[model samples]
Target: MSNTQKINSTITHASINKCAIPYIRYKLVKKPPEKYIKSLQLDLFSQFVTNDKSEVSNTVEIWESIPKYFLTPAQVKKLRTDTGHADPYEWNYSEKGGNFTVRIQPALIKQGNNKYQAFFPGITEELVEEALKKILTIQNHGIHDVNKVETWVRFSLRMVLKELASRGRDRNINQIKHAIEVMSSCVITLSKEKKEIWKGSILQDLVTVGREEYLADTDAQHIGRLPLFISHAINQLEYRQFNYDRLMSCDEQLTRLIYKKLINRYRHANLINNYHFMYSDLKSTGLLQQNREIDNRKKVLSALNELKEKNIIANYETDERKESRAITDVKYIIYPSNEFISEQKAANKRNSDSDKHSIDPNLISVNKS
Candidate 1:
């Protein structure tokens, strides 16, 4: 059967919104070009293809590949706008069918003689996300030498700022700076096992060596050192690659968080076409918060609609079952977008090929008997 026919059959029984689904009609390449095949063969055999850490690639770098737990659900929370300081909070939960418990605890970091207290003073999704994003850039590009005991990465501050506050022209420079400061200042312990075997901060040190010039277009370079634990974690976990452009285009923070959570949740289950999210599931992500349940529900729906309009997902089908004149146990069918599927497929293919080659370095020859 053709790809189009398979997709049609999948959607037919699902009862999805026809209008919002983008055209997924892609013609199959029956005979790939000789050059393309040769490149594929090279990719299959070559140990090295491209480095993410090189200066050239870092300029336009977007997609960040890091440990899933860093940005996954329950990592971040909604903060009140007027709050002066972020009160320390603890998160302990299990994900992916309760495979293992994930825990986050706010703690202090010791550097040399001085000790710094880590707090989320004005922590926002974008802020913590920026720090992770930059670190992900470093990890993805092989810019930092992992073999070294301490893997420190330095990157363009202005470039990151531009990407973080891409929604606005002026850029939220102050906000980004503060978030990085708070995140870098303190240490957070992440443990997965019941015995608390592993623990460390995502970042060890964040320093600005160059003085900031107010009028300068490009600010001084900023350096960040990742803890060995965090570096190892990034290398260990499987990462999902999505369209960074599409993700950033949606200005709403909540929507972006939802998108990421969905991506992380379904990173491995590609065959699972539909994801049914409950009301509590949505609220847990810190995407929606209000005094009343009704208000919060409205916000969740609004955010989902925004994602739908932006084509972040193919479409969302709402299942609002009324109980006591109030919507309870609201469920949603989140259809994966074609664009997202294609990107993930390509990323998985590349990763699988890389893993295959990495498995047996001596078996390089492809014998055609």
Candidate 2:
């Protein structure tokens, strides 16, 4: 499989609509001229790859012997297949089952109280500062009472924004601006009841981040853990509550796979199963007929079965008002959870907020004065 990368800055992405790079990166891993590299035999050269972390090669002794292990791309391919490995066992970046475009970034350093700084060229320093302020305020309260923690609160803010950029948000200015603010600012606050910041999906309106699947720390099949230099802020969502460190672990990798599979069928199984789908009600109200998808009773039944298997609702009976009015006419049904209303309310809340606080599109007009 040959691969190429497309790096974009809003304009290029607009002109080239298919610019969003998917999983998998291709590297030109080249071999050096024979006698010279062999003669030097430095410690950084790779030998055997364990879990694909190349950092382990530093332990090898016998300096001249190291160069022999610097295998060619063809040699690496043969060795990988010989060992029953499908990949070259190297640390690489990729999107879900898609090719990767190698992205490079400079490191960051913590500054004075409640501040952070990074050396990346593409983004503005002002943007970084504003994002850090918002995010730090939110997380600071989580880890320590904001009033007590005197200094910048010992957390890595840079990592969060970088997570967004790495997931491909940095490709567009509109998205970058939206994400930096969304990840940093307090769009929704905790409503004392669930300690849940039960606000609607804040970034839904903006083409800010990638799809929901990208919010998770995906597998090597997508991209490996983002570079450590970036902070948790990048991948953290205001409405979602997932642990960051654990998201990169092997267990999370498996969970991400399960989540993707399950979500692909989200509308069918989990959601429909829970709805007390009054076929008669949906039909009379025109939700079924107007929807065109659940036009007949069959899709509704299929959705109900999936819901039942997923345990989204409990079993019950449906009394068919106009059926042949028999005792056995009742069928089991599922009722949507109270949380469903919350999600809807949250969605509405998001709509209102967007109306109130959205950025002016004219400001973003490109290639013109």
Q: Highest lDDT: which candidate?
A: 1
- Against the unseen true structure, what C-alpha lDDT does each candidate score? 0.44, 0.26
**Model 1 over residues 1-369: C-alpha lDDT tens digits?**
111210111121011222122333433222212131112222232222233212111111101211222332223334212332234454444333332233333334333457443343222434444434444454322233322223344555566576555434234665555555555554343333343322344444555554335325346655566544333222322233444555656656667667766665554434356776777665544445466888887877777887888765777787888878877678877887765665556556655755554445342332211
Tens digits of per-residue lDDT, candidate 2, 122-233, equal 2232223323323333422112111111112112323445643543323344344433333222122112112221121111111122535343422211111111011111
Q: After the best TM-score superposition of candidate 1, give how far the Cα of residue 269 lies from its true spot, in angstroms.
A: 8.9
Residue 295 of model 1, lDDT score: 85
Q: Clash pairs of candidate 1?
A: 52-141, 53-141, 118-186
Candidate 2 achieves a global lDDT of 0.26
Per-model TM against the reference: 0.60, 0.23
Model 2 residue runs over 4 Å out of place are: 1-85, 88-336, 360-369
Instruction: Give candidate 1's total backbone clashes.
Output: 3
RMSD of each: 14.7, 23.7
Residue 241 error, candidate 2, Å = 9.4
Number of clashing residue pairs, candidate 2? 19
